[model samples]
Target: MDFIDEHLNHIKDKGLYRDFKFFTSSQSKYTSIDNRRVLLMASNNYLDLCADDRLKEAAEKAIYTYGVGSGGSRLITGSCKLHDQLEKKIADFKGAEAAIIFNTGYMANIGTITAISDQEWIIFSDELNHASIIDGCRLSGAKVVIYKHCNLDHLQEKIKIHQGKKRLIVTDGVFSMDGDIAPLDKIVELAKENKILTMVDDAHGTGVLGDNGAGSVEHFNLKGDIDIQVGTFSKALASEGGFVVGSKSLIEYLRHKARSFIYSTALSPVTIAVSLRSLDIVKNEREPRVKLLENSKWFQAKLRKLGFNVLESKTAIIALIIGNAAKARKLSEKLFEEGIFITAIRPPTVPDNTSRLRITLMSTHNRKDLKFALERLKKAGMELDVI
Candidate 1:
């Protein structure tokens, strides 16, 4: 207990401690936090479907039909008709032979990685991959080789150096922190050349990229090329649960070997229903996706014009870098005071001296909302001397 307090104090002193801001209202472009309405710029609800009437109706209908709670794990009574339906729908949506659902994206990554690889295997991972992927690599007991962020040449060199019969190359399709898209096309070329298995966790890309919003694979026109594809419904889909789509044999293998899937209770039927409805809506509603990307581009340009160090991104995420952690926190607090809600990402989440504001956009946010945000940001930047 003393050690825990010491650790907490140390983090607080360094401005690395975190706490939650409870939201009373539904997740939307604008929501209530601490009973105060603010423009939300930190959520992953890219399609703004979290508060959609259609999704709410779907949840209600599912509740009436199936009741709440999954009752047990998937291999037991928890495997309902909705679960089966959603899995099939996800497989079709991602253009895979089959799919298996997990409790979370974290569980999916860990289970998939640990189940497939062992001490004998070798894994090539990106330096900026999500924490779950990093945990999975560590848990797998495989020889993990980290390549420089989005550096194909580094990945090629690492691939050449790490010789193994069972080799895997895994990366995040859209990096959650940096707001950069992985060069999956070039990575695939490297993998094929080296005969290594490839995996992509498209948690941030699903329902936000590609012609049909299938994700990064579709965005890059390499649908059937990647060996393993992992994604989540909680982000752009505005639902719950994670899923991995691959070959039928791979799905079967995960069913038997993935401990997270085997041990955890399945997602409720209501969640599955919402995910199903959201998928249908996302596939058909291209206007929102287009509008969202357009908004991201416009907002990034505006931030840059205001002299913020904004990262280049093709997706709906914007990373505004503020090198000092305490200063970044202060900037975020100032923005919140001005009725803008943007979380300040800090150390451990990002490398030291790279604290940033991870601004995500929703399609429902029009130019007016963006302009309001930009105005607040400009004022805060001036006050904090961030510009």
Candidate 2:
């Protein structure tokens, strides 16, 4: 445990140590943290479905009808009618031929990426992709080539230098930390010209982008062009599972070959129920999506007007870049002191000297709530000389 202590000390010295903050209440406008009611802006519950009364009832019904846990992996004893129905619902929502669920967004990426490619394949990945995608690529035994973040020219140049039967290009639909959308349309066009497969992890985009919240691919109008679309229910969908949407053949292949799916226990009955209902809400309700985007744009505009660097974000996620880790931590602490709850994201989650506050907006956040957060943020920025 000496190495563990050393590493912890090293991170602490750099102001990059991550300590968990527990919330006593459900995800909402206010949550109890350290016995204080703080305005919650640090969560990914974009649509505010996490604490909906309907979902709570659905959870109760599901637990009563299907029991507490899935007994085993789907291949063994876990497959149920609810799982099948949920998968179908997901496929329809994504406009894909089929979809398969996994225990988490991380597992979905790891399983899908590793299953589709091998050591003989070459993967062209964006530099700022999520850690799950990075890990998946590493585990795939594939030759990985990383291009500059959202730089189409760099991606094209890298692609030209590589030749392989199975060349895959992977990127996040919406960057988690940077809060920017990938150039999916351009990526699809490039992939077609090179006959390469394209994959997008739309975890942050699902239930928050495009018409009826079909996700970033729909926003880009590249539904059939993209090969694989992976998303999660834990974020805007307000549940606890992940899914991959693709062709029927691809789904069947994953069912047989994806080690994460084959080995891990299936998602619980209550989660599946919650996810199904959440998807219905995401598809049927236009108000939440519209309000969330409007809130994000308004908040980002306000930040920019306050002389804070709000990165190019067209979605509910926003990032305020503070170059130094210590400064970012100080800003976050300042916000907390003012009864606002936001987090400082530092390395290795982000690059050194680019630490930021990964602020996420929700539809449920009213103007008053936002004003409070903004005021706190302004004070922090002014005090820190960050504005």
Candidate 3:
């Protein structure tokens, strides 16, 4: 208790202590949190499918039919019909031979990386990859070679240095913090040259990238080329599970070998049903994706024009680098006071001296909402001298 208190106090002093905001209403453009209705710009619900009426009805139907919980581990009795259907739907959407599901995106990364790699193989990962990927590499029993974020030349150099060894290159399709995309075309080409496998954790890309929301591989037209493509339903798909799409054999291998998938109880029936409905919405309605991207481009351009250091982000996620943790926290608090909710991302989620405000756009956000947020943001930035 003393150690916990000491560390917590230290974190608080550093302005890195995190506290959750309780939502008193559904996930929408304006959610009631802390008894105030604030415009939500910190959510990952890029397509705004979380509170869709069809999805809610589907969830209700599923709950009425299947109950709340899966009784045991998936390998025991937890596997349900809805789970299989959702996997097939996701596989088909991703244009893969098959797909396998996990309890969450973190579990998906950990399970897949550890299940596929051993001590003999090396993993070349990007320095800015998600924490899940970092932890997965640690647990994989493989030598991990980290290259500079999105620096293909450094990756090539590392690959040359580790010649003649079985290797895997893992990266995020859309970096969660930075929101910049990976160059999958060049990565695939490099992997082919070295005969190494490539894996992409497309957690932030699923249901948001590509023509029909097939994610980064599809966005890059490299479908069936990347060895493994991982995504999560909790993001754009608006559900509570993760999936990996690849060859049928790969899917089978994960089903048998991935401890996270094998040991964890399957996702609830309502979640599976809601995910299925969300997939249908993502596939059938192209307007949401179009609107979301347009809104992102407009918002990013507006932020940049206002002199905020928005990094090279072309996706729904955007970051305004504020450098100091305390300042970033202050900016976030100011935005909250202005009835906007954007989070301050500080170390160790990001490197030291790179703390920033991470904002995300949703298709459901209107022009008025964007205008209000922009006005509030400019005011806050002026108050803090960030602009």
Choose the strongest candidate by TM-score. Answer: 1
Model 3 C-alpha RMSD vs. true structure (Å) is 0.9
Write the residue-wise lDDT of candidate 2 on 100-183 in tens digits: 999999999999999999999999999999999999999999999999999999999999999878899999999999989999
Writing each residue's lDDT as its tens digit, candidate 3 over 201-255 gives 9999988899989889989999889999999999988888889999999999999
Clashes of 1: 0
lDDT on C-alpha atoms for all candidate structures? 0.95, 0.93, 0.92
Give one digit per residue, the lDDT tens place, for model 1 in 312-338: 999989999998898899999999999
Indicate the residue-level lDDT of 176 in model 3.
Answer: 98
Per-prediction RMSD in angstroms?
0.6, 0.9, 0.9
Task: In angstroms, give how far residue 201 of model 1 lies from its true place.
Answer: 0.3
Residue pairs of candidate 1 with colliding backbone atoms: none
2 versus 3: better lDDT goes to:
2
State the number of backbone clashes in model 3: 0
Q: Which candidate is the best by lDDT?
A: 1
Cα error, residue 20 of model 3, in Å, equals: 0.8
State TM-scores per candidate.
Answer: 0.99, 0.99, 0.99
Alpha-carbon deviation at 365 in model 3, angstroms: 1.3
